[model samples]
Target: MAAMLTQFEDLAADNTSGATELIQRILALCESGAMGNTYNEIREGLNLLEDAHSSMPSLHTVIQILKSEFLPGLKNADDLEQSLRYIVSLQKILEESGAQIAEKFLSVLERPTRILTISRSSTVISALKKAHKANKLSHLYVLEARPAYEGWRTVRDCSAAGISSTLMVDAAMGEAVQTAEAVVIGADSVSSDGYLLNKTGTLPLAICASEFGLPLYVLCDSLKFSPQTRRDVTIDEHPDSEVIEKEESDAFKVWNRYFEWVPINYVEAFITERGVFPPEELEALSTEETAADE
Candidate 1:
């Protein structure tokens, strides 16, 4: 149990893994009977994850399920077994959602098209690979997301999948946008005001894409949508050491914000497991969901 908790702690500290991947691992941990034997223990485990990755709405969804649906039912050994089965079912659902999102995303692409994207999203990568497989994707341009540099992982995955891709610095988004036919990105969360809360470079990428009249699509499942407004959302600031080796001094101060908001007007569409929709439609959907919950 101690070892399992330590492993989960390390996973929480990881900044590179996408939210989908992290949620899957969290479900696996719960199914392994390693989270804890009692409700408090499991709750603590979930709390650790929430604290570490507050920006991930999908992860918060998983945590909510475990807390509201599973934790309350964990009374006996038989109950624990039932909870594990529930976790397994949820994991399968998430997997299917990912595949569905990829399929929907592929349907929107023009044949032999080039795509430009920033940061690393498991869902976006899955869709790009699917498009490549279908012969609809000709080339991919990846922006090397700084701080965590997760774009390197995206390029590696693209290469392994035999997809033609180019890696460029985040600042080269203006140039990359001009070369690609469209922009596709992944969202950490879609804010209540219909803005995208994602990697720090996404706002600039969106600006470039919009200025060039290139369609910018956000690929994510509905689980990534948050009921919180932009002001309510927490934007994590990583260590200053990630930006510079030198400590803060009278000479300079390093600011290392990991995420930022991109205006909804910059996005042309949002491709999700359910279907593709425009920003206005998503805004209505978000409003409906919030009202229903209230």
Candidate 2:
């Protein structure tokens, strides 16, 4: 995930060579057959590239042409270069507007306010870092997103960047929410109905945020949008080993679900590269797509 974001960062200056090299690297990774999450990585890269090229109409036109010309007949994964180009082209339409979306989030922040968040997302982290740099962030409250403990990494990174943050057990989220000004999260996927599928524990945090009347902001690029609805999306069950050790086996079953669903109404707004959008707007967007698909 970090590597994919790094590739996007290389395109910060709108360098075509940088974008091409990133695509080449992505293709190489795809060919290596080691990418456990190729589709998401592609979306992330595409989101970044789209942001970099948002102001360049000629480049945007090139992206559209690439998608229109290459994507339709993509039959298999073996067509690696074609697939990469197709992804880049698809990004032009599907990726969010860009880092400007993150900038839009700064309006909701007040100086010296505590923001609650969970897990690690390149997009969410980048927004928080930006807020910190602007001196709008006073503190960050992170839940120790477990089975993987990705939140620990978030806390560590925040500390390294000189942002004061606290790491708490997942169970402490409700208590933390009481004092937090708002909650921010990253979506693994946003369903057709505008529901967010994110790391486990997000739903409860969202519920808590809603209960307290605190805003819950979802930071993500539009490429995270998936065609599936909540019921249609397959929830992956991770290995029990992720939650338990080999020596700690118990007769009781352990379910290690890596993600959870948070309904759209629980979110205050979606912070995207295009800008902040209400759930109604997302629903409208989805409705338009459904109509177009017919």
Candidate 3:
């Protein structure tokens, strides 16, 4: 399963033949209980496919639709990365207008232009690094997304080059969101209507940011924007084996999902290389897309 998912991502990175079918297979693996070596793998696989498909915008539109509605469930991110490295090698090919959309979206985040900073990890943090120079990121409050704690890596990478950064419990996001000028978190997938499904705590944070009137920015490469829309984005749920031995708890009904949906209303803006827009803006974007097709 791990090997298969890796192949799928590689296909995605190249934007070559078999990518769509390969992606379908990868999703199947994720849902098939091959969770052990698939957790983090699917995210990478999806990212590559999303990025690659971005260049072929029309194709991406289709891919996004499929991904949003239903993504396979995988468990154990570490085990899933074997194939990730393969696709990582193909990054350059995957970026295109999709990457631009991602960058443009993130740039708009600096309202006062430069004050408080945002924190993120995984693909999003990587996307931010590409657009903002380390020094440019200097006062941003980049938090370490936890459990996976990939945010530590973001801090290290961003700070090493001079981006002032920090690490915090995923639980601390509320306080951070309340004080930060903008919450520029990354996105794993976006539903049409502009809802975001990302790391577990994202939904609540978006709400908190909304409650506090803070800007909640979703930084994603346009490619990361799955072809799928609202009804398309499906939550990937993992097995209880991840939490307990199944022997440990008498009532072990663990419903663990790697990502979640942040309703459009909760999202302040979407940061893609294309530039940021208010959540309502997605409605307009959708309309434009429809009109163009017509």
Q: TM-scores of the models, in the given order?
A: 0.93, 0.68, 0.60
Report the candidate with higher lDDT, 2 versus 3.
2
lDDT of 3 at 11: 63
Give, for candidate 1, the lowest lDDT window spanning 10 residues. 33-42
Off by over 4 Å in 3: 1-94, 98-123, 130-135, 142-146, 223-231, 244-249, 290-294
Local distance difference test, each candidate = 0.84, 0.68, 0.53
Output the TM-score of candidate 3: 0.60
Model 2 agreement with the true structure over 1-294: per-residue lDDT tens digits? 777567546654422121222333434443332234345554555445555533222233334443445433243456656655554554553324435655888877766578999887756777788898998888999998887888888889888999999999999988999978989987767877557877889988988898888999988765566666678666656677878775654677778876778888888889877667888789666566668769
TM-score pick, better of 1 and 2: 1
Whose lDDT is greatest here? Answer: 1
Supply the TM-score for candidate 2: 0.68
Off by over 4 Å in 2: 1-98, 246-249, 287-294
